[model samples]
Target: MRVLVTGVTGFLGYHIAKDLLKDGHEVINFSRRHTSEVDELGIETIKGDLTNYEDIKNALRDIDAVFHAAGKVGMWGKSKDFHRINVDGTKNLVNAMKEQGAKYLIYTSTPSVVFGKDEIKNGDESLPYPKKYLNEYAKSKSIAERFVLESNGHGILTTSIRPHLIYGERDKNIIPRLIQRAKSGRLKIIGDGQNLVDINYVENASHAHVMALKELSTEAKNQGKAYFIGQEKPVNLWDFINKILEAKGEKPISSKVSLKIVYFIGLIFELVYKLLGKYDDQPPMTRFVALQMGTSHYFKHDNARVDFGYSPKITIEESLEKIKN
Candidate 1:
């Protein structure tokens, strides 16, 4: 299969493309910028912006399937910016896929789309989108997810994979942020510190995409459906973070703040940032951040496992060792 992976420079997308190449598929990377990974992999590359219809259309010239992994991921940003890249960009890709006759589209979605300022235990594909999203990132991704799923049966079969807290080797964002905060003494437990959360290793999460692509059929059973992808088990959130810190030879986070206190502080910071017109910069605290850090949001992957035979090849212990080394 000639697979076109958008955002191939991103953590998940990069790993997905690498796996496709290893499986003997002709991989075409579509990204706004070239990274060392692309140069090293030496796969065919297309420089394009998702927001541009022509750029995306041209890149889909000979593609058979698409891994639409590009998205604007952030806790804070201008609503317009998130809409442009996440929602509008997805619309453009869908249009291009229609025009170019691409058959399958696998989107990389987030569990935050269903997060509504509450604990979510063992969530599944049946979980509904929140009445109100905790942040703009989730809102935009939700809209984009709908666009992709709703587009299914229009000659293109599409599915969304919602992977939570993906982490492992070559992770440029999540783990590094944790280490930086621990070093700066700014890291603190937001709640009672016993909340459980789902996490996915990069390799396992990327493999889920491959499984979805192979099993995607025009039949409704697999088409237009969304699946939760994660490790086989959930871990206590604070315990997991502390383990990573210990692995890095750093002290674990000790300071604690009640959720109510953090939520109030987050509200204040949000109001101040909005008043200051700091649209590009994230506030130190926000309601979304508070709930995310303090709540339990784990999910089961029974649907993904049964529908596509997806399972994590790397255990949590092995994943931690990869991070430590």
Candidate 2:
């Protein structure tokens, strides 16, 4: 199979490209910037932006399937920025698929799209999209995911996989940020630290993408559905962070600030940042970060299991061992 993977330079996209190449598929990597890192893996590279229709169409040419893994991901940004990259980019990809008669589309979505302030304990695909998203990232993802799922059944097999807090070797987001804050002595446990969250290892999350692409069938009832892909078990937030700190030979520090205080502070930051025209980087903390850190949002993968045999291969213990090594 000739597979085209967008965001091939990203953490999860890199793993997906490597795995697909190992599976004996010809992989074409699409990204705004060309990197020798992917070329080192012996995969073809296409330098282009997802929002450009011609770029997407050129990448889609002669491609059998697509792994739509590109998007703007952050806690703070202009809504237009998020919409342009996430929503409009996906629209471009889907339209290109329609024009080129691409066979399959496996969209990489985030579990945060269904999250707000509520405790979404063991929720499934049936859960409604949150009425109000805390940040533009989630809002744009929700809109784009709907487009992917609804774009199915037009001779294009489409499905979305929602992976929560993906982390592993080569991770540039969560661990590095945590280590930076810890080194600066600015790291703190938000809220009571009892909130349970689901995290996915990079390998397991990438495997889910391939599985979804292979298992998407016209007769399968889950064609237009989204699956929650993560480690099967949930871990308490504080305990998880402590494990990471311990692995690094460091002690975990706790914060005593109330959630209300942080949330209010985030609101003030948002207002001031908007008024001051300063939206380039993330705020010290945003309302989205506060809710994500303080609230519990683990998901049920029964649908994934039943539909695509999507059981996660890497356990938390195994992931920790990998990280430790």
Candidate 3:
């Protein structure tokens, strides 16, 4: 089998590519530019943008399956930019896959799609997309996930896997930024530090992707559905943050801030950033971040397991052992 992984340079994308390769499948990396990781993998790569239909079609022409993982993700960004990449880009991929007669599409989605300004305890795929989103990233991803799921039939099998707070080795975004913020005294515990959330090990998340894809190839029961993948259990949000900080030799974030205050501050910062056109700069706090940090959001993957045999190959304890300060 031949697989094309978009955003192969990214953390999850790289893992997905490696998993596919390990399974004896030929992997093609899709990205805007070449990276050392692709060179290390020594596989075929196509330099392309998801926004370009020609690029997508060219890459998917001979590909058997696709793992769509590329997108602009952050607490802040222009709505149009996010729409172009997350929404429009996914549309282009679906269309190109249909045109190329690709067999399967496993889209990388985020749990934030269903997370609004509320607490979700042991949530499942039965949860509905929030009618209103506090950030553009979540809203755009929601749209993109819907589009991918809706484009399910007609010679293509599409499903979405939403992984939350994914972190592990070669993580270019989550942990490093977290450590930096902790060192700078920018990170803090919001609420009572009792908010529970799901954090995914990179290996486990990659395993879910592979298992789900194989299930699609075999049983085909998971098409047009979404599944949440994460550690087997949810951890207290602040406790998890402190554990990472401790592992990195940084002081644990002990300062407390009110969620309401931070949310208001975030509102002001968002207004200022939008007015100044500083779309690239991430504010220290945003309403979405505040809600995420201060709320309880964890999901159950029983459906994924029952339907596709999706299981985390790496446990959180095993994953933490591999992390170095």
Candidate 4:
């Protein structure tokens, strides 16, 4: 298969590309930025923007399947920018895929799409999109995931994989951010410090993408559906953070803050930033972050397992070893 991996410059997308190459597929990358990984992997790449329909159409010319892993991800950003990159970008991809007759599309979605005002435990793909999203990233991603799923069939098979709290080698977010704050002594346990959540090691998350790509097709059970993939077990959120901090040789976070106070502080930060017109700046305690840190959001991957034989290839113990090395 000639596979085109979008966002090969990104952390997860790069890993997905590597997995496809390992499987002896001819892999092409479609990304706006040129990175050493692409050059190092020696995969053919088409430099283009996702918002540009022409670029996506051209990128799909000879591609058999696409691992659409590109998107604007953030807790704070200009809503318009997120929409342009995540929503409009996906629209262009879906339309271009149809026009180019690309057979399969596997979107890299998020569990945040279903996140709302309440905490979710053991949530499944059956959970519907929230009535209101906590942040621009979730809103835009929800829209994009919907586009990818609804655009299924009509000669194009499509599905979305939602992975949560991903961390591991070459990680640009999540773990890195935690380590920075922990080392700086600014990290604190939000709420009760007992919330459980799903964490996906990078390799495990990327393998889920590979599994989806392999199983997606016409008449396939995975077609047009979304699946949540993560470690087989959920971990205590703060305990997990402490493990990473320990591996990085930093003291664990001991301070604690109430979710209500943090949420209020976040509201104030948001107002100040908005008034100052700093849409690109992220507030330290945004409502979204407060909810995420304070709530339990583990998911059930039974559907992913049943549909495409998905499972975490790396355990938390293995992940800690990788970080220590």
Local error of candidate 1 at 53, Å? 0.4
Runs in model 3 with CA error above 4 Å?
none
Quote model 3's TM-score.
0.98
Per-model TM-score on C-alpha atoms:
0.98, 0.97, 0.98, 0.98
Query: lDDT tens string, model 2, 67-179?
Result: 98888999999999999999999999999998987889999999988987788898988889988988899999999999999998886878999999998899888988887
Query: How well is each residue in 1-325 modelled by candidate 3, as lDDT tens digits?
Result: 8899999898999989998989999999999888887899978789999999999999998788999988999889889999999999999999999999898999999999998888999999999999999999999999999999988987799989999999988998989999988878778888889999999999999999999899888888999999998888898888888888787787887889898898899899998988999999888788898899898999888998898998778877787777756
lDDT of 4 by residue, 36-142 (tens): 77899989889999998999999999788999998888999899999999999999998998899889999999999999889899888889898888699999999
Task: Report clash pairs, candidate 4.
Answer: none
Please, what are the lDDT tens digits per residue for candidate 1 over residues 1-325? Answer: 8999998888999999989999899999998988877989888789999999999999999889999998889999899999999999999999999999988999999998888887999888788898888699999999999899999989899999999999987888988999999998899999999999999999999999988888894333568999988897999989999999988889988789999999999999988898999988878889999999998999988989888889999999998888885
Candidate 2 whole-model C-alpha lDDT, 0 to 1? 0.87
lDDT of 2 at 155: 69
Locate the minimum summed-lDDT window of 10 residues in model 1. 214-223
Model 2 lDDT at residue 80: 97
Worst 10 residues of 4 by lDDT: 212-221
The global Cα lDDT (0 to 1) of model 4 is 0.90
Cα-based lDDT for every prediction? 0.90, 0.87, 0.90, 0.90
Point out the worst 10-residue segment of candidate 3 by lDDT. 316-325
